[model samples]
Structures are given as structure tokens and as C-alpha cells.
Target: MVDKFPAEQQRIVKGLQDAVDRLNTIARGVAPIKVNKASEYFDLPEASPAAPGSGVRLYSGGGKFTVKTSANKTVTIPMADVANPANFTSPSTQTGDFASASAYTQLRADCARLHDTVRDLQNAMRAAGLMG
Candidate 1:
């Protein structure tokens, strides 16, 4: 039998999505993106204008927080995260022509792979006899 850990986990997730499919449109997210997770704040590369702990979640590239298992979630950022300074530029964390081009590409590819893996996992889990 194929591995049940990851597969079953994904099936459960897919089942959740399938169930949500019957919900009203209003319960869904906007057209572009539909998510209610707190970590969604980092969806953008931009920094938040609001001060720290403003009782709001933002896309600022600072601070570290736990996510899921917190495996690759232990993150640390420099103060240069958001520079409202007159001379604002993509910080070192940014992967532009200035930064390591190859590293940027590799990271991009890795993210894509991870997304697909999780997606497949979720799909597999929903396939009867895989998880449930």
C-alpha cells in the first residue's frame, strides 16, 4: 500500500474544500484570492505602513512567527525590511537583477514544487480509500 501519512492528510484537506464548495458566494474570498489565514499577510512583497502590533496583520518583511509545524517558519528579518526612506529599493531579501539571480530562480521553483506537492497531497487525501 502507498504511504498513508501524506496522502491521507491531503485527502482530508480536499474533502474540506469539497464541502465548502456548497457554500454561498459571499462566504468565499475575493476574485483574485480566497483565504482567511493570518499568514496571508505575507502574500505580497510590500511592507506594511502601520507600526508594529497595530492590532493588524500586514505584509511587512519583519518579525518571525510560527506556522504549522514551524519547520521552515523560523524566520528573522533585518530592520531594513521596509524603507520609507527617500531612496527605497528592493532589500537584500528581494531577488532581482541585483541579488543572486540563480538563487532567486531556485527559490521560485522550489515554491512552485511545494505548492504542487501540497495540492496533490490534498487531492490524494480526498480520493476515497486513501485517507478515510
Candidate 2:
């Protein structure tokens, strides 16, 4: 009782809707990634005058690279500057922690759904001879 072309068109529309839904679901599941700053170098309390060596000690803290000199002088080099001083130790590139397992699971599920939608979309396009 319905036109064959309209029926087929409806099927294609439904497939596209499904694909969009999957994409939306995947987007919701995605997580943002953050990178951590490199550890900094600190100067331990000046050893007694007669004490052993004292120069600079490496210390990790908020993402910043800093160094302390023997005279209790401290200097911090912005990450951007690390590269300016060619031949200098490159700043650390360690990244921050990751999302929770549950979040990851949800993301994975969404990705799977998106994958399925892509497949369906491809099939619809093929049936329409939109592809060679």
C-alpha cells in the first residue's frame, strides 16, 4: 500500500538516524586528556659550611621546572624556554593520570556503537549506488 521508493528511502533515513545517534553517544563517552608538567630541581637547605656538597637537587611539584643554586638562589625556566636554550635538557613530557575505568568502559561502548553505525551507513550508501 506504500510506494517502494518511499519505503526504501525511509529505510535509508532510519539508518542515518541510527548513525547520528551512535555518534552522539560516542561523543558523550569521550574523555579529555591532560598532560602533566615536568618536575623541578630544588636546592636542599644549605648544608653546614663544613658539610658535604650542595649544588642543585631535583624536586617534583606543580608542573614546573625550577632549579636552586648553592647560594640559595632559585630560578624557574618556563617550559617554553627549555627548547630556547638549545642543547638543554628537554622538559619532561609525562602526562597526567587517566580517566576512571568506568568512564573508559563507557567510551569503548560508544566507540563500538559508532563503528556499527558507520557500517550501516556504508551499506546504505552502497545500496544506493553512491559508491563505485
Top candidate on TM-score is 2
Clash-forming residue pairs, model 1:
10-121, 10-122, 11-125, 11-126
lDDT of 1 by residue, 1-132 (tens): 876687689889888888778564546655655565565344444443433332434343544321221232222222222222232232436534645766666666666666766666655545522344
Clashing pairs in 2: none
Q: Write the per-residue lDDT of candidate 2 for residues 88-128, one digit (tens) a residue.
A: 23223323545656556655766666676667666655554
lDDT against true structure, model 2 = 0.54
Candidate 1 regions exceeding 4 Å error are 1-98, 129-132
TM-score of each: 0.23, 0.26
Model 2 residue runs over 4 Å out of place are 1-97
RMSD of 1: 25.1
